[model samples]
Target: MKFRLLLSLFIFSIQHLISQTIDKEKLLEYYESQRYADAAQYLQSMYPSDTKDTKSLTQMAYCYMMSGKLPEAEKSYLKVNSIEPENVPVLFSLATINSRRGNKAKARAYLSEIIRLDSLNFNAWKQLAGYGENADERLKYLKKANTLNNTDPDVAYDLSMTYRELKQYPQAYEVLKTAIAADPGNFTLQQAQLPVANQLGKYREVVENGEKLLKENTDANVINEMGQAYFYLKDYQRCAALFKTLEDLGVRNEGTLYFMALSYRELKEYDKAEIYAKKTIDEGISNHTSIYYTALGGIYEQKEQFSNALEAYKRGLTFSSSPTLYYRLGLLYDFNLKQAKNAVNYYNLYLKNKPDPEEKDQIEYAKARIAALTTTKELVKK
Candidate 1:
């Protein structure tokens, strides 16, 4: 009886070992096929307390990482690192996990170690660039990545942006030009090239790329950029057309309205210009309220609506002490309304603001008006 019982116990142990081996084989197959959730389930069931199984542990870590179980993945990765210190794959995995977790400092340390282990790791350098404390540090890492693989469009794009952040538009433009030449079909590279070109005052490039982007997508940003380029190039008709399209698309704002007003004004469409100018003031560009009000007054004046122009300029003075507005008020009162006293008051206000050197003609005109108005006032009193 004792011998039979012992034989039964041995048979049971052999069956248990066979089951575990089969389960492990299934787990590995699942992992190899990228079925991480299945692999994780099998690992949890068969090797619940078996950190000694380094292969299983590594597979489980990757499974956890792929499944978005970040904390669990991090714990598993730490355990794997303890067993095989300085494993490059484990280090890279840890870095990626920490980066997703927003632990940038820890991720940077891991990536630094990876680069130290293998200096030619382009991915490590590229990842490190995003963790830099400043633009200079970012440039250093991005430059290394670009040097390692200049043909990589993504690396070139990142390096170009870093150059743009430092206000090095010429360098940024050159980098993007090279990148676009290499990857001509990449629409993102083409779109990015526009802003840098615009900054360099390459309006021709802006117009060309912007038109191409518009064909693919009528994105409001692209439309605004194209419209601005047209405005700068003195193509008011096209500029107004684009801005009107933006308005139809429900993108009316102070900036778009202001540009629209300017475009229509330049094209002698005073009524349309006045509508947009009024909208710009109502929408309120907080820093440039005076400019918008002045524009409204100018629009009204262009329509020969002197009373409205005077009222607009007077209301604008409540918001800003703009010398140009004061000068315009002086002219309106002197020439349009024939009020010498009011003209003298406004002309003196204009002189007080110390107008720019380019305003020498206006300055001389204001002084003469002040003298003439003062003399006329004295003669009327006598």
Candidate 2:
């Protein structure tokens, strides 16, 4: 009778244990239905302790993450990590959470661990590139990522930009070209190709690629690049037309104004050229102010407005003692204004400043003029 009673008790205990056990499929059904909160609750009730159930713990972490319970998600992920220390997905999740939380150091540590376990992890290398301490480190990681996955447009773009930033123009151009070939309609890669081509002195390529971009989208940046390409090609009319569009669009910065002024000047529209050149000066891009003033002076010289030309050149001198400006002043004073003394002074100033190698001919001419002017002055004094 005692043995039968014990057997009945054991059978009841087994039935109770089976009833209390949670079905993973039921939890998955809740998760798959987008009932993440319900799944989390069910998992919590079933696995109340930090059990060795990595799958359940990972699902719970995902649920916490999807529900915006980041702290809880992090705790659950850590629990999974404790159980499966070399788990790449868990490590990557922890890295993502730390990155989103602005914990860069911790995120980097996690990514480093991932790479240590699986060196071919492209995503881990790409993520690490963002957290690099310097440009060289970033470049290193990006290059590795690119080697692993050259087909990704984002990876190609990033690697190309890194090379461009380091002034490795040829590499940038090559990478961008390969990326464009793979994804021909990628506007970003096409646009990026323009500047690198320009840097490589491939102005014709800029025009070709830039025109292609313009056909698809009338982006202001694409228009500006096309205009620059035209300017370099000496297609002043086309350059001026494109720049006018930019001006009409209210995108008239100092660069656009300078290009517009130069284009008009090349086309001999002196009045319009002077207007844009002076506008460039008013825009206060100090680095190019000297060039604007010089262009304005050249326009006045073309119109034979000698006094205006002189004033413009003098204003330019205040900003930059450019040898070319000095030479222009010497020519204006000597030939047009008939100020031999001032001409001699300017010619002397031009010689004193080290002129560019391309100005060798101009330097020789100045020397001859100075000698003649000084002789004339001596005879006049006598």
Question: How many steric clashes between backbone atoms does each model show?
Answer: 0, 0
lDDT of 2 by residue, 277-379 (tens): 9999877547677788899999999999989999999999888888989999999988998888888899999999998878889999999999998889542
- Weakest 10 consecutive residues of candidate 1 by summed lDDT: 10-19
Pairs that collide in candidate 2 are none
Model 2 poorest 10 in a row by lDDT: 10-19
- What tens digits encode model 1's per-residue C-alpha lDDT throughout 1-382? 6754553453344334423554444554575577777766666666656555566677678888898888988888899889987899999999999999999999999999999989999999999999999999999999999889876888888889899899999988887788788888888877877778878888988999898888898788888888888999999999999989998999878888899999999999999999989999977747688888899999999999999999999988888789999999999988888778888889999999888879999999999988877777453653
lDDT of 2 at 307: 94
- Which residue runs of candidate 1 sit more than 4 Å off their true CA positions? 1-20, 28-35, 44-53, 286-382
Maximum-lDDT candidate: 2
RMSD of each: 14.6, 15.8
Top candidate, metric TM-score: 2
Model 1 residue pairs with clashes: none
> Candidate 2: global Cα-lDDT?
0.86
Please estimate how well model 1 matches the true structure, expressed as its whole-model Cα lDDT.
Answer: 0.84
Off by over 4 Å in 2: 1-29, 285-382
